[model samples]
Target: MDVTTPPASGDGPGTAPADFTAAASPGTVTLAWTAPATGRETAEYELYVNGRPTTVIQFGAGAVPSGRVEHRLTVAEPTGTAWAVKLRARLPDGNWGSFSAERRITLVA
Candidate 1:
């Protein structure tokens, strides 16, 4: 019998999360996004702050079926420093997809 491995999933995830936003209050920043279609696999989200990978957030199957995922991060940047926040999702295959549109926010005291 001939055996062959199935083709790898082309490229990466289909599309990035559509609704991504960030807000800053005092010394913390809040990021939120609607769960993207994961092609039926669990998705791991990566958070990029000012072009650096800062954190990874995971969403299991059916984790956020009705609402969006939100996280609050404490920042120590000086006031008036603008920060760029972006997000990307990874498939179970370890491929990181395109990043979401960046959201810029200035920190407050």
Candidate 2:
């Protein structure tokens, strides 16, 4: 998917990403979610790990409101440690939305 940076303002507040899910393997986790319906384009998505912000991205081109976005992340921490993750996005139609529900993940060695 494509990605870009835009100001965090819109006509109305955007909705949160839905159906967040994760899968884990040795040292890594794959995260996925359905983006919110933000109209024309999907704005910036902020990824939080362990309760702290980690990354920001956009689901370029197609993955806007209803698209499913998937991300693979490498966690250097030891396996079995809980990884709490969530996402907040700047909706193209409104201000940044609240983060999606938290998803806890654990890597497997």
Candidate 3:
């Protein structure tokens, strides 16, 4: 079992399709993503915002408990700025997969 990051833009045999979903609630942004085809079992999902990584959530196979990796990111105070949510998968062997498409969303006050 080989674990690797997702391929760079225009750099993979096939473009792995990933889903970036966001749900705005009273005080948090529920973010999620679909799994990517990395030829290996994924162990977790890493989330990044703006240009910095925020957190890495653990995932278990069949534990599809939620099926999707979710992040409950909080807003300090709803600033009118666009935030980029990027996702990456971790292989069961401990290798980080490539990042999925960047999803940008704005917070309206």
User: Per-residue lDDT for 1-109 in model 3, tens only?
Assistant: 9999986677553222277787666557788766766665456777788878988766566664343556676776565667887777766556676777787777654
lDDT of 2: 0.78
After superposition on all CA atoms, what RMSD does each candidate show versus the true structure? 5.4, 10.6, 7.5
lDDT of 1: 0.80
Model 2 backbone overlap count: 4
lDDT of 1 by residue, 10-104 (tens): 87544576689999999999988776677654357899989999898776667634347787888899999998999987755678777888999
The clash count of every prediction, one per candidate, is 0, 4, 5
lDDT string for model 2 (1-109, tens) is 9999897676664488888888889877898888777665565789898999889866566554457877888778776888888988786655778789998887788
Clashing pairs in 3: 5-97, 5-98, 6-97, 6-98, 64-67
Best-performing candidate as measured by lDDT:
1
As for lDDT, the candidate ahead, 1 or 3, is 1
Q: How does model 3 fare in lDDT?
A: 0.67
Q: Rank the candidates by lDDT, best first.
A: 1, 2, 3
TM-score of every candidate relative to the true structure: 0.73, 0.73, 0.63
